[model samples]
Target: WVRGTRNGDMRDSPEESPEEQDRDEGSSPSDAKPDVTWLGTPISELGRMPDCGQQLPRLKNVSGQHTVLIRTDLLQNGKVPVPYPAKFTDTWDDVHVKMPWSGMNLFPVINEVMVLEPDAAEHLFGSLLPDMVQLALRASELCTKPIPLLKGGMNHSITMSQEQVASLLANAFFCSFPRRNSRKTEYLNYPDINFFRLFEGASPKKIEKLKTLMCYFKSVTEQRPTGLVTFTRKSLDRPPNWKSSQSQLTKLHITCEGTIEDDGYGMLQVDFANQFVGGGVIGSGLVQEEIRFLINPELIVSRLFTEALGHKECLIITGTQQYSSYTGYAQSYKWGGSHQDSTPRDGWQRKCTEIVAIDALQFRSFLEQFHPARINRELNKAYCGFARPGERSQNLSAVATGNWGCGVFGGDTRLKALLQMLAAAEAGRDVAYFTFGDSQLMTDVHNMHAFLTARNISVGEVYDLLGQYYSSVCKSCLSRRPDVSLYSFIYQQVSSSLAPDASDN
Candidate 1:
């Protein structure tokens, strides 16, 4: 019995009858606004749109309104016979697409004006067309009924089937959500899951990300695995005294290579995400967690219901299947190939893995991160993600994470590492920290942990010592030592705090 199985399947439970589904499907296309259009055309009508003309041919829906436009000859059996413009093709010298014998192909059917170079179209939609259409239809049908929204701050989990994930993604693919396009302050609270943003600014890197996403959709729709996934949010009323506890630290592994997904399988992996949930999934921001979302696209659907994460709130997702393989990081990213996830499932027919998304604070100034309020916020956030659900009796697995806020967020790596250890200690979980090629961080963290372990210091004591250390460091710029690192500062503070007075002796 999995932790969240008591409620039965939360997705596509067949509870809704035909009449209920029809009523919830909303009105016909005629009733929809003129601007509303389908995402792409059916596979049977692939390549119907004229190519290389004065103006691109646009597909119109039944209501005689403009829809998506696609070009078929651009791609055939994964071969890009038509070359792309120099700008877009510069990075494709070594690129190759290995098409499966029989799979679907999808064309970009967008309401907005998009002029595609023949090469770009072939690279994006060459081998994954028909599967995309099926996913789109399934998504639209699921969206007919409102997704049941769970109240935030509740310590419970929701499990979704693979079919449910496809449906949710289809809705995102077509941009069918009513009020998500706007970035206005009023809509800031909602997650942006639509792919329209990615289509706006076309670039080599952006197209590569789009290609990666398309491959993910193809795998999930075609494979249709019977596994299930779960999302759980955990919140705590009070912070735990991590330093004072005598509990041994969970198994710790430090590395400078490998990623969370590839190296940390069967463990509770961490997604260093943005507060808005689906960081840049629908857009072009490809970093740590965004890259993860691209590979395991099923994770994208959580944005539909997930609100902006609070400092004390974190989401733990279990059983999401990885669909694609990617190469490179950030701007240098490229889609490698399709991946067949063979991870074994648990008793409830779900992959026996977990991923926790806990956002680290984005500090404007490096020194601003040391503020007690900010520190406490990060501590709570990490703890929320690491904490196990109260309903489960089993022990929690260790966490796999690295460089949480060091990249785009400009966080101090040493300080962030200490914070993660503290939070993991509080929750009684060990950590597998990947430095991602930062050897200095690996060495520093190893030394710091060794020192702390030798002293048998508890997390509560470390928390107190951090307050004093930061205070001293903040007193005056001239008085503060320029060369002191966070690890050295803590080591010095703890050593002195435990030192005996000569007079008392």
Candidate 2:
């Protein structure tokens, strides 16, 4: 979400499309705004579960207070969102539990965008509501299970049962998470936990999103996986000295086809992230990050406590299994169907998939990125995410990335690619660049990589070259000249730097 204090607007860069955002989406009669001003009314018959009188300090941290709705014990001690009570374990499980009256405390904020079948309630959970309650009883046990609350400028990691994640998310489908839905809610900086917004909107796109979510709940409730998922916050106390490193460019495979999720497997996949990790999945903003989260709803749990990323911090998540499939991006987005992720588990019992979430600076004015400080911030961010803790540079996996933050964030793709290249090279990892179906980008980036390789360019040289480009072209271009692309300028500079002098001739 946009962290602007000027207007109190938490606008997010939920890039609706690659090029442009749909200005305003009108709602049909069914798509009218959902008024969730109340949560006492149960949509489904919920079997009561007792809230044992237990007391523990609610989960709290610098990021913000965490409200685990599935824990009824926390709710008993005035943890506000405890709509109803549920006691799964003899203990409160540290997560406030309430047998959700229904599937989700789906918020009203997304009602304008969410549309489902006329009998959406019966469509998915009709007769299954009781079974859902039983499943939530199982899921509620994770309430007090500590999901490492990721704060800024500190390293943290969370590895837990995939079953626990699915359980917590199942509760999210049922809207007991009231605190995160309000403007002044406790998780003011966090994304909304309730799907109520999408449920009320009744729009086709929101309907599609909800459908995908329903599929996840259906899939897990039927058979919960025993795999583990990990979320690690890597904070770089000292970024590499880019000006002195003699690192060489790692291997690169740029393609105009395929995706980072499916094709770029067994590597470090990049999440072109928002300061708020999940972006606008619960809202109208749908793009790379949102789509990824929808397909793997477990990632959405990071919104539970992941504070907005600091400049030097990045969150690395491993073992997230893709659940559903989809076609298209933003407005053209459509859920394909259930995708059973058969990716093997590592020794950690987590999925083999490794995704690094590095939030790029939203270059409000693309030109604002010309400043070296902006470039430095992104380079360090990428390195913080890419650098492995114990693995040597030789063993560090390649990075799968494309036009990160290049959409509505206004990142110059060329500049971003070079910056990432420099970061990856210094980290001693290779790179896999997905052009996202852009042929020209593929050709240009490939050509640039080839030129740099031929020159046997060192990490420091490339670093200096970027600085020179910013100074010689971008810095002056804002007022005096129309600057050429970084590739063109760098090609000229690197070629000239290696050129033969008259004395040599």
Candidate 3:
């Protein structure tokens, strides 16, 4: 389950394609035993639920073919491996999930979290197993309604209750939803939404993540959630005139200490996502996007319906609750306990939190991202994420983001930062950037912002200057110039362009 990755955005590692990775579901073996006493108290028998009561909601605008609500009882085709060409949500097979706890008992898996020993975890899971299954069973009901697949090139949004999100996450925990464990053709485009990958590798970070998820499960099992969340996939049919527009850069607040989740309040938070959205969260890779998905488990539901993001597409998730607090990034990541979310809600009861996921291109070589096409692609993706309804209007909120596609993606931080700022300028949004503990980067970006604002430069100037910089560095594109750092080049060229000329009118 330790797959390869390509980018700093935290995907499966570079060497492996998505198809080559995770061929096996990596679930525990069938021979694994359950604790009869569950370490002390008796494990409760699975309860017989009356017909599920939750009302299934569908998009009023379209026929209901796109959205598949889970009605487990109705899903009893009695097949282990589901029939081909069917989505798990559509089939809702009973054989994969029913009775006698197939594969391994969940006890030892919980022990590794160190938050709860096998005994304690068994007690908690075993006790709540009945109710958890009940929630999983009520998925069609708990959700405000069935969520439509966020297919590429289509603009769509779905609303679900927080209890609905938790219930769906509970389903993910049980791996009850079928056909998600492998990279099969039926669900090849989607990220694996099952918990099987969380148990893979059993690394310390994975353990901590499991603990955090368990905490989320515990809380939701105890209380009813009234808050709601919405997932919106926005696609741009037309983009801005980046090389011609005179739009000026907006306000920038750069910091190195705080993070996007904690520090970025009342702003559009950016998820440096992979094209596959949740990236490697269910697996061993725990980075920015994966960590965010784990902490806000509700976002995991998108994996059930969202397809691979198209180049011009971006995903916006509003009102997702952060169930757990966390420390560190990637492998150093650790799970802190429950976070009580209190953000104000809209009339629809959806939390006010808004997060946009924009996938950055992975550059195999240091110079790859500097290519004009690549630069424009990243800029376009960012612009798509930053652009909102009536986006040209002022009074838009600031975009909270950091160095996207840098680190393992091999993107130059200075270039990425400038591109994001340029994108924000075009979208009419300000930027609140976190340098991810890099004080020098924070200072450099802040100074760069100050220089641009002080000179009152146009967005097209920077955009074209970036193209020139790319052409200068990329010999194949055009004649070469002496290469310098991106910021230094920008400072020199922008100043020279603004300098006095003998032929001035």
**Candidate 1 lDDT tens digits, 135-159:** 5554333322223332355554555
TM-score versus the correct structure, for each prediction:
0.71, 0.77, 0.76
lDDT of 3 by residue, 415-469 (tens): 8888999998888777777665466676688788888888988888888888887
Candidate 1 vs. truth: CA RMSD? 20.2
Q: Which ten residues in a row have the lowest lDDT in candidate 3?
A: 40-49
Over 15-114, each residue of candidate 2 has an lDDT whose tens digit, in order, gives: 3333435311110012233342112112122111011111223332333332222322332221222212343333312232222332343443223222
Model 2's alpha-carbon lDDT is 0.64
Q: Is candidate 1 or candidate 3 better by TM-score?
A: 3
- Candidate 2 residue spans exceeding 4 A from truth: 1-129, 142-144, 479-481
Whichever of 2 and 3 has more TM-score, that candidate is: 2
Query: Which structure is stronger by lDDT: 1 or 2?
Result: 2
- Point to the candidate with the largest TM-score: 2
Q: Backbone clash tally for model 3?
A: 7
Candidate 1 residue runs with Cα over 4 Å from true position = 1-127, 140-145, 150-152, 185-187, 241-248, 389-394, 478-483, 499-505
* Counted clashes in each candidate structure: 14, 36, 7
